[model samples]
Target: MTTSEIWQPPSEFAEQCRELYGLTCPPRWGTPRRPEYPSLGPKAWKVMERLGFPPMPWQRYVLDVALEIDPATGLFAYREVGLSVSRQQGKTQQILGVQVHRAMAWARQNIVYAAQTRGMARQRWEDEFLATLDDSSLAGKYRARKSNGHEAIIWRKTRSKMGITANTEKAGHGPPLDLGVIDEAFAHEDDRLEQAFSPAMLTRPMGQLWWASAGGTDKSAWLNKKRAAGREIVERLWAEGVHPRIAYFEWFAPDDLPRDDPATWRMCLPALGFTVTEATIRAELEKLDPGEFDRAYLNRTRKSTPPQDPNVPVAAWQGLADPVSQAGPELAFAVEVSQDRAWSSIALAAAREDGRVHLELVDRRPGTDWVIPAVVRLRELWDPVAVAVAASGSPSASLIDGLIAAGVTAPEDKERPRRGDLVVMRSGDLVEACGQMADAINQGTAVHRDQAELTAAVSGARTRPSGDAWTLDRRRSLADVGPFYAVTLARWALVSRAEAGRDDYDPLDSVY
Candidate 1:
């Protein structure tokens, strides 16, 4: 086929691609609408054929991008490539094809394949890498060495080899690396090992780094950070701008899609029809937790591990539910925002006639932009005793000036004496409020109207240590706990006022 002719997939593979949901990065900053020619796919296909596994269309597309060369420099255009798909989508097969082609066809030297653990690295090398090479047509042409600290394959002619090592800061040293593969990239907590591994590739003219992973914990800070950066680049491309250096591909259902939807399953699992049948996916979904299924099969990063023991027990929180809404005279309000500024909630805690606090979610909305206005509207309606807002460590921190502008401020602020309606919950007070909320739930002193969103937030509330105390851990929770925190702050403000030797204070009457 000529370079000008559009490359067509094999008949079987084309049929499979038609049946699947596939997505790929359009192209690097300034590239053709479609690849003109593939420098790597043909070579990689030969080895896949030898191994009795052919390249899927999606896999072939990845190879074309990974090896796409710059016309002027004759070097790869994208040096860093990220491949994230649901588990069992034949990522290992794709990885194997690339490494083999690099070793045999390109005769590349000093390549390292690292896994999260030594045992995992060894198992992959033994079960897949060595088994493929040993069983292939080129078995007699290569040498496989398995020693205590040394596991590698050597090309007999050029002595070019691929080394297998555990992911460690010390592992990527020694030889100048031509290519690096980080398998299960999501398991890496930080980029320290990657940072150390990268310098070896700096001097190579054709150096490349490929990251492959199934989605991991939401706490995979490093991986999430890179994913965010990759998304920004894609956005820039959509805005008619370009990021020349990086290529990112994700095979996953959109986060908002129904997890059990067949289309969503097919979208994330490119090999659903081939390696895994629809029946198999259904069975897997039935067997796994929703969060686990989201992470493993849907290729989503979620809070996989719920706190060992949450601040509020499910039973305890359920016990506090009063389905019949109650209203009390002395009402206080609190506003809280998610750490990422994605969602915010305002909750009210009213002092009940029975001395217990009755909580209710007043308003919950996306983004911080609506928070100040919502607070102002609630103030006008209820004339709340105080509106507790986080002074630090919250998206609401930015709302302080806005609240003050709307005549809400601290009582001690003489400059804004007419606007002393906002009670700033500092970091120390925030921690105390969280503990207090937990205590009230345990003691059944905090009753709630049993709102679904608030219940979910309460159920997912996990505590994180903050100095001598602990606060709600929003990041590790399954859902946004802003509602939970908002209620807590409101309750604390209401009770704190009553305990401060102000028995005659009727906050509702005073405010109204």
Candidate 2:
């Protein structure tokens, strides 16, 4: 059978297939020749249509993959089915339809629907499954237990029940489940819940586990790992015509695509224009932060982990942009070099008359050679109070020789000290500077003129613990957060000088 012989697909779905990325399966139209086996997909589709829940072509295609039978055993080939697509693309409706079929067609197919929270799982039960049952001919044939202690839908004829459970190790412990629908699988960080539930399905020969979710962060280790495993198997299926027992279906945009681009959004969202409108998506995007919109709607995962609580929120950094480029009399400079020594950045902080700290990324260049010359030139022009350097094992250590060559001197005696033009900050002092930067942002005292590089660094910055204290985790950050560190150090120098009440602060006499 050819696509022309099949019914015309919905315009939105057709568009989605055209732009799809992260593919690792036999695409709907490109399913290769395989062994003869009876498929329940068409039967399921007909049942859904009879119940007035006619599925889209893409939905039907996913059903085919999930329902594919093994030629040898006359049962489903795949024991696990994973569907990862954007929200508002009718995933809930599809899952509800599949469960309904199992409840009606199969005898005693005990199923469980699980979500991140019990309330969410219960809500989906009442809203979609129950609503569909009520509308269909199966209404009076089933008994509903909607209470807290007893939440299930029991088919009066077959005595099979579809239960709801939260994503916890204790959930669905006693029940012998034939099918488990894991809703919001992206929210799961580990497989403890799945491990707990697996015992229920172990004895059943036809047991199936279905996972449906939008893309989540790298913190969702279990889902990400499963997806990767499924992808590897699917790739083999596409290449060698050998199908694995795990059915994985994913619809997402390429990583290089811009989140705001309509093409990227269209690729991930199969129900666009029908269930979700562009205007609604744009409005919701306006309300969300950088990664939130992409994660929820675009089905794009964050490539790396960010700290649980960041030193500065991306929104606060975005809010503190002040367009003034003027530098006040009190100026300080800070330099940051990437741990890999591939890049370095110079930042300047000025104490404005309004008592606000103005920050800017003065320069960023490859290698450490240009860094010293750039710093020296900036110092000569601005006559800064101090050039601060975080004496980390990497960047600061390498900068010591460069500073000496630039004629910037550091104090030899730390015990009885006056600050020199070069301030070599180490240990607790560097951590204090990080905290001070966060304070300035929270108090609305820190301002910037808004450079793209600086904004990205601020958004990507995450923290790591140094004993009881925390410092920026540059390695975990998606990009170099050097600009953020540099500016924070510069801000500390100016604020510390002011706090000491040193009016005639010699470049070499102020305390660090």
Candidate 3:
């Protein structure tokens, strides 16, 4: 066909443009919009507009498909709808419009909106939903109940109510829900919310369930399962020409696409031209890790695999254990905190006369309150060459000010940290520390005291990308990695001081 002829039809013209320039990626799998099907989407859009929230093009498209009515039954065609899109795409606003429409159009309807936690749900309901409603023309139409546990928005005439709840097994249990929404479904690890809410909608003929989120990691088992099922259903429909009562829409960049290209972003992010700008995405790309940026912005799920070799080999780590390992006169001490701040660890490193590093776990305890006092006591006794902390982008960063307040002196000049000055390590420094520690263990240049805490930390250590190198990923580690980090920092500080020709220590200067 001629180019001019192809451009004659609107759909054909759009398809040609898309094929040539890679403009947009439609839902990867879902029910296609049928013009013949009547929908309440327009009314929902009108409601949103009246409340000063206009639907974006993508939102309008989703609403039309998700709210399509069955001609025979005069009810919603889809019983369950799943929407997976990148963050900041206005999913909440679209869902809010739908909720408002359902509440106003139907009599005595029960609508429940849930988030990952009860506090988050309550906050969103109050800050976003109710705040918008109260500020708009719709304020006079409903009465809000702001009680701690009994929060609801009740329509004056219809008596239809919308409530907020946590994504627990008990969510939507008491009410026969007309609509149930689970926001940020990626946080859910299982199908507890589905099991609880799906049954509640069975009796209501017009009931619908909605799940919306950005793409998640392998830990998001429930969302992953739902996405897989949605893909399968779409494939089945394409082959057999059959329709199902489930609707799934996904806007995700294909695995093969170049992530850095703006064209690729346009294909995946529906709000690129409307709400979000390319400049904003570019800034985010530079700031966030590759895996995190993909999940948050490209709507790409992370499929984690078991590492062929652990970050630290268990056998190598175990073999380097020494029951009576002790530090010499020249010493460096380091502190680290668990990812959740539930625990903290202090480690000591010393250069032995035998040309080996002596590593020991000084102290590990629950809570952060004791860290400052413990560090102070250790400093007075050991007179160490350096006091190290992996502070940047870590929970341990919370201790920096407290350490300073307790008379712990940090280096005025980072390039040359004086003896007994705190060596605050950034991301790059931490990466170097991890590499140095790994090499020392593998080369038999380091010996540890074989403490259980140290062993557990080494065994469970995981790595995350930091620029060109990697560092310990406390979030993904199976066990508390504070001890491991602490020792790594300690060794790094000792090595750094020696390499810089600044390890001038005296045993007589020790306070103890």
Candidate 4:
């Protein structure tokens, strides 16, 4: 009847037990009290107890939020945890609680917590997580292990550490992370996404990820893409097939809430602890326009919001595309180079399923370190994907020349199409592409990451008066569209390349 006896018990006895009881309960418990776990359990629990596996107050809520216990392992069994509560739900505090427990309670356990903003590194530790460390009592168990401007953390006696970081490549880079908890994950980059979670999933320890956010759209963000991919994995795993270490949980509404119901708004928030009370919710409620509230609160987005340029009135041209689908050559990417901006863009312009180009992709770069690198990226990364990009400017022209010098095929030059050439208009290309892109999105044809900069840029880009008319500018541009700069230059460069029959040129002439 005991575990030792059960194993030594005859095969006939085991078969009889299985046939008699649906459960695995035997004479091991109730009959006797054994101090140690039955032989079947692994040695990890001893390490877990030493490292800090059992969670505390706020973290208990998170564990309960994702409460699927793995019976076989006696551990919380979830591949991913996604929290979409409104702001100030002690968001970072909840993460800190669990992170500390995971590190202190488990050995070789790695935890990385990141947020979208620059100052979040300290805010999470000093303002949210490490506040517990300073309380004197918790400090006895854990000590503030380290701090740079980028991060600070406490080391548990068990040898596990929590690394706090802001949302940037430098912070998210190369580490053997076991648990990755990202705040405002919608702000992460699409390409650099590997830095965020790849290390965790690929490791033998196999880290789980937690993606938490308030609300945003895929106007232009890497996190937008990540969250989208996360959603797809969660929503369509059965159809998409199984992923080994990926699980997703998003708790939110289908879209914007109804103005008629105050209770419904209260229910959308996860901070049921009265911190985000009815009074605060109402105050926030009073400040929101119906549209903004709908987008921000309900996790919905409006694709065709007007760009900054008032002259570029909401073009009737673009339509919304699918969120989880793809179309061919509907968008062309244009990249731009600058010595000023810290980043470059690869604009994914719009095209349609109906054989018309609608959207554009632009990848931009700032001066210095990004110049040659951006050009190299354009050459290798784009090619077959983008229809074309502007290959003008000193940097771009030389980049193209160097490629030709190294033996590359340049897109054949087309004569500069003037404004009168409405049939083949460049601005028309943008407008038409954007229109189709919008249509594609509305119709469910494209995929984008939900993010602040991209959403703000797209929604904020508008026409402003220049001379007698208006044009898209920064407070009104969709983004500092480096891709547009690249594509636009490429358009002109091809033409100039044909006329000059030379390998080098730089024409900064969007206007004569």
Tens-digit per-residue lDDT, 1-512, candidate 3: 11111112225423532453333556555456656889987888898887788877777777877899989899999999999999988888887888899999989999999888989999999999999898888989999999998999999989999998877788788978889999898899999988989899999999999999999999999999998888777667766868799988887776545568898898778888888999999999999987889899988886564552355766788889888878897889999999888888999899877778889989888888999899999999978878898776889988898888887888787787667788889877888999888888888888998776787678778888787778888998867888898999998888776433343543322211
Query: Please, what are the lDDT tens digits per residue for candidate 1 over residues 1-512?
Result: 01111122234433433343143211122122224533665677777878667766567666766677767677777788888777887889888878878887666587789888878888998899889878777788778888867888888877788888777788788888888899888888989767867898899888888888888886787787877676566556546745466777666555546677787776567777777888888998999998888888887786755554545666788888898968676778888888888788999899776777899988887788888878888788776667888886677788888888987767775233222267888888888888888788887777998777788787777778898778888787767888888899998887665323334564433221
In model 2, where is the ten-residue run with the lowest total lDDT?
1-10
lDDT tens digits by residue: candidate 2, 179-252: 88898888889997688778889888878888888889878888888777766666566568677677877766
**Candidate 2 backbone collisions, by pair:** none
Q: Which stretches of model 4 miss by more than 4 angstroms?
A: 1-76, 146-151, 170-175, 191-193, 237-244, 288-292, 302-304, 307-512
The TM-scores, one per candidate, come to 0.61, 0.58, 0.57, 0.45
Local accuracy of candidate 4 as per-residue lDDT tens digits, 1-512:
11111112234422432343321211110011112323211222232233333322223333443434455665445666665545555555556555765776677576777776667655666765666556534566655655465354656577676776656555556657777777775555443544656654665343567777665655536545655565555435434544334444333443323533665554445453344566766666689876556545544442444424433322321233233334232223344433244454544433344433233333332443444444445445533223233333223333444434433444344443211111122443434344433443444433333322333344445444544433334343554434433333333322223223223422212211
Q: Clashes in each model (backbone N, CA, C under 3 Å)?
A: 0, 0, 0, 89
TM-score of 4: 0.45
Which residue pairs collide in model 1, if any?
A: none
* Greater-lDDT candidate between 1 and 3: 3
Predicted structure with the largest TM-score when compared to the true one: 1
For all candidates in order, the CA lDDT equals 0.74, 0.74, 0.82, 0.44
Kindly report which residue stretches of model 1 are placed more than 4 angstroms away from their true locations once superposed.
1-39, 253-258, 302-458, 461-512
Q: After superposition, how far is residue 240 of candidate 1 from its true place, in Å?
A: 4.8
> Regarding TM-score, does 3 or 4 come out ahead?
3
Candidate 2 stretches greater than 4 Å from native: 1-36, 239-241, 302-477, 480-512
